[model samples]
Target: MHQAIPYRTWIHANTRDSRDLPLAVRGAGVDSASVAKLVSENAVIVIGRRGCCMCHVIKRLLQGLGVNPPVYEVDEHHEAAVAAHLGAATVQFPAVFVGGKLFGGLERVMATHISGELVPILKDAGALWL
Candidate 1:
């Protein structure tokens, strides 16, 4: 049987981990304790609408990647300014704020994911790896 879902569905019903390949491999690299400490101390704020497809997708993506950043709803009482600035002007849903910087919307997130930059970026921004 065939199933249908929203365009931005971040479904993982039958998906498996693609982590078999080396994700953090390096020929000659040194781990920095300071960076690790800094990352652990930061927080990521994800602004999104409750029913938005892209929003759901982004949320699921982050969660599946083992990162559980705090999620805020634009329609909620708090985070009004953030929602206003993101939605009123740009009509963007799922506005991700990493380290207090606007990280754009779902398209940007997809781009980052496709480009294989999301992991490191999220790591640096302290948004993921929970």
Candidate 2:
């Protein structure tokens, strides 16, 4: 199944290596420039406090939709900084970005999924190949 596999599997495979990131790469207020690069670079990202259950929910939903987004599990102290970098007014746990833009949190994600729009959105975001 690895052969001709969609990008979802690849994203999930890489998610396990997050623990290897050095402290500097973890946060320290998550410098705006680096945050910009992160949002611009990935098709989908889940920014939330480390070990947040809501973040896990978002990730699982995406995976169920065939999109395994790489999450940036930030520290609580840096949520505001990350939120500002993403152009949001306030910090929202499990803040999701799709196609390099803020896609809101669990509420928006679940709404989109229940409405049957998530798969197409993931496809358009290039996070889903099938």
Candidate 3:
């Protein structure tokens, strides 16, 4: 039988300890702390899985609305960490942060857009022009 490497432990087994690696180095270039920091530093940012369709949809939607948010694509390992930091009830991909706050997922975004509040929110976030 063959064994597999545990997540975030893709480094060679001979390495002293995975903990020695920086948080960003341990996995997909993001730790929970980095994710939190990214949210706080940006007016708007979307943290989503690398190849997720919802991520694409969210990005396109924001662009269509004249808001270009920085989309940080994380791999699956980083996704769960980000989700927990985002405080979502479940794993929500393409988690939106507006004005340095969690703005929920795709459904919430769609609802806000339908309600005509997305533009105002984007304006407040400084992600869109007046």
Candidate 4:
């Protein structure tokens, strides 16, 4: 009665068009200043890819904790530049930033949450009232 789509096909279908992306945004060779500006402005930011399961997990985790972080897709923004700027080139994607600072990726975020440090950070950033 129902058909299941392949993972790759689903990803392709959901991917944003390159033309829709902003001209100022770039991937690997992007400027670090732009990334810094973005991080410094947002209370909570998550740079990730739409098709990444880990990214989804990280977002959901934040939401579960009553925090709504802005998610920027790598395909739509200069994620590499942000990663390099944050000195997290080795661990990008689902990269978290709180209180205008790098909070690390999935592992770090999970560790912080498990250690009960994430809530205070979110509160400090004004991302969570509760």
Candidate 5:
């Protein structure tokens, strides 16, 4: 018999620690503290563009899972700053965060869901009642 590890610890161990990441991927206007605070307080957060199709898909997926994640639409000027703060390159939209940890983008979320791990993670993060 194997003991199951809590999703938070499992996620922390699986994902790269944001603290060890460089201040900014693009090296400009990155406020690490603000990014950290936003993620920490929100059980789930999706930062994406208002008109991006992929962003819509991500939001829909979360909603289908019974999650009500906050979405922050990135404006042109703040795009770089948000990307850098999240340690993401090239201003990727729809960055996902769960339980105050960076959970990558749509592909990662989909992969986790396909692997049947997303529900446990959502439950652990208090984003799911079931």
Candidate 6:
């Protein structure tokens, strides 16, 4: 026997890894503090796709940093086009933006944090640990 599933759920789950999140390749001039502030305030959107490992890692990293980010699925939202274009990315999975600026992908995010750039950014953004 076969199991049944909801159409919307199926679509969302299946499109989790679809090419729709545009990420900036040249790395935009985004300060980590700006991102931390937005995420901490839950004002910025954390664009992500379901079933994406990189996306998951980004979320975990943000959480580790004590940031509760607002998540959005680019492929599921038409307005994402504006962000994608502004981000200058090719709709890659897991695109993070803060204060209307593209903050690059997981690799960049991790690198910044490891290089001790994330803390200062988060602190300036008023989202870092006291």
Question: Which prediction has the highest lDDT against the true structure?
Answer: 2
Give TM per candidate. 0.54, 0.76, 0.71, 0.65, 0.67, 0.54
- Score candidate 2 by TM-score against the native: 0.76
Candidate 4 local lDDT, 1-64, one digit each (tens): 8999753212121223522333122233344564566567668877776557887788789889
lDDT of 4: 0.66
Q: After superposing candidate 3 on the true structure, give the runs of residues whose Cα lies further than 4 Å from its correct spot.
A: 1-27, 87-91
Off by more than 4 A, model 6? 1-44, 76-91
Candidate 3 per-residue C-alpha lDDT over 16-107 given as tens digits, one digit per residue, 9 for 90 to 100: 34334321222255556666666676677776777678977887898899876666667776666667766665757767889988888899
The 10-residue segment of model 5 with minimum total lDDT is: 7-16
lDDT of 6 by residue, 33-112 (tens): 43334333433346555455676677678778877554544344433453444446474557676545566777778899
Task: Assess the local accuracy of residue 47 in candidate 6 as a C-alpha lDDT between 0 and 100.
Answer: 58
* Candidate 1 to native Cα RMSD, angstroms: 14.2
Q: Which residue runs does candidate 2 get wrong by more than 4 Å?
A: 1-25
Clashing pairs in 1: none
Worst lDDT 10-window in candidate 2: 7-16
Error of 2 at 91 (Å): 3.6
Per-candidate Cα lDDT values, in order, are 0.52, 0.72, 0.69, 0.66, 0.67, 0.51
* Model 3 pairs in collision: none
| Alpha-carbon runs more than 4 Å astray in model 5 | 1-35, 87-91
Report the candidate with higher lDDT, 2 versus 5: 2
User: What does each candidate score in C-alpha RMSD?
Assistant: 14.2, 8.2, 9.5, 7.0, 14.1, 10.3
Ranking 4 against 6 by lDDT, winner: 4
Whichever of 2 and 6 has more lDDT, that candidate is 2
